[model samples]
Target: MAETVSHHLGKGRLVAVEGSLQISKSEKDGRTYTNPQVIANEVRFLDWPKDSKKGNGQSAGYDDDNFDVPF
Candidate 1:
């Protein structure tokens, strides 16, 4: 399932996270719950851009916003 999702990312930077939902029964309510458990060693990063800092890396028209940020 993860492979199919990454393939659709189309050469973009993709992070592969391998894990499974651990189903457990709650003793208090007898309800089943799914908890995500990520395998620390299985995480991967793929397809980084050639230039990390391309085109100033800023959103257009954001530099000239007229709103006062009263900290």
Candidate 2:
């Protein structure tokens, strides 16, 4: 299912997704754990950024260099 969505979304597209949450419990090694899951129901594509080609011909929001700043 995710593969199909990824294919439709393509490489550089953005989407607003809607989904439902599922909660489950499991016991492992005498310990109980709660897990939450997201089940995707709908996805709406958003417009591409205007400065998509500013950096390296990729979207400005997706530039790898944006995360290179030193703290």
Candidate 3:
């Protein structure tokens, strides 16, 4: 299955995702346990990219020549 999300990204906008794997420790009843997990450290909106869209008239790697898209 597929899902859709709507967001406003103008000509100049930045987006980023950062994640890492680390060990997590927990204590229960004077006993300690360790678990490893993958974590998303940050999602940063730093700066705009010179080109987020790919080459040619199509944006997001879709062919815009065939159909007219209203945006």
Candidate 4:
């Protein structure tokens, strides 16, 4: 399932996470609870700040002209 969390989503980047819900039963209270666990599968950068000097010195925004493809 694809779920979006406020803390995980941000500007200039995209995050793809995969995981499943974990169900556990407590021995003390005999109560059942569900927890969500996720792992990052892939990350693709969509944009960045123009003045930001970070990550290979690439500027912000989408630029397809300079994009390189490997066969």
Candidate 5:
């Protein structure tokens, strides 16, 4: 099963996600991100968690993951 979400992004708007995802800027916006290449830029896997109960025995809850960016 897969989940999909929609959001509004502005000029220089940025988002980051873990694991694999598809990312794109809507045609309505001048900024355009397309296909696998665009997906590649935004998806990252966080460091494996110390706890062993989640996500292929890898990642834990979001709080345990590092968000190094200042936003």
Candidate 6:
């Protein structure tokens, strides 16, 4: 199963995180440096509401708002 990460939909707290982190690297004069690389990252969900519409999670077979029936 694919890993999932979920943050607090309210107070913006971390709920879960599953993934590998990769740090950035730089090359200069055939040398590499990794001091200023990213150490960690956090995923958060803020825009999505806490309660979403209940349905089959599928798009309706109607375009009532998108367009009219092309007869």
Poorest 10 consecutive residues of model 6 by lDDT? 1-10
Model 4: per-residue Cα lDDT over 1-71, one tens digit each: 12323322356554333434455544446766655444444333444434554465464333546322111
- Residue-pair clashes per candidate, as listed? 0, 0, 0, 1, 0, 0
lDDT of each: 0.41, 0.58, 0.46, 0.41, 0.38, 0.37
Among the numbered candidates, top lDDT falls to 2
Give the alpha carbon lDDT tens digit for every residue of 1-71 in model 1: 34534333345555565555454444447766655554333444443434344356332222334211111
Score every model by TM-score.
0.30, 0.44, 0.26, 0.29, 0.20, 0.23
Candidate 6, residues 1-71, lDDT tens digits: the string is: 11332221346432333335566788999999875432224443323333435353322332224312221
Q: What are the runs in model 5 whose C-alpha is more than 4 Å off? A: 1-5, 21-71
Error at 30, model 2, angstroms? 1.5
Residue-wise C-alpha lDDT for candidate 5, range 1-71, written one tens digit per residue: 11211222223434455444655545546666564523322333344334446647443333446423221
TM-score of predicted structure 4: 0.29
Query: Between prediction 1 and prediction 5, which has the larger lDDT?
Result: 1
lDDT of 2 by residue, 1-71 (tens): 56545544566667766878899999999999999997777655454444555645455434444322111
Can you list the residue pairs that collide in candidate 6?
A: none
Candidate 6 off by > 4 Å: 1-14, 27-49, 55-71
Provide the lDDT at 62 for model 6: 24
Name the candidate, 5 or 6, with the larger lDDT value.
Answer: 5
Show the lowest summed lDDT stretch of 10 residues, model 2. Answer: 62-71
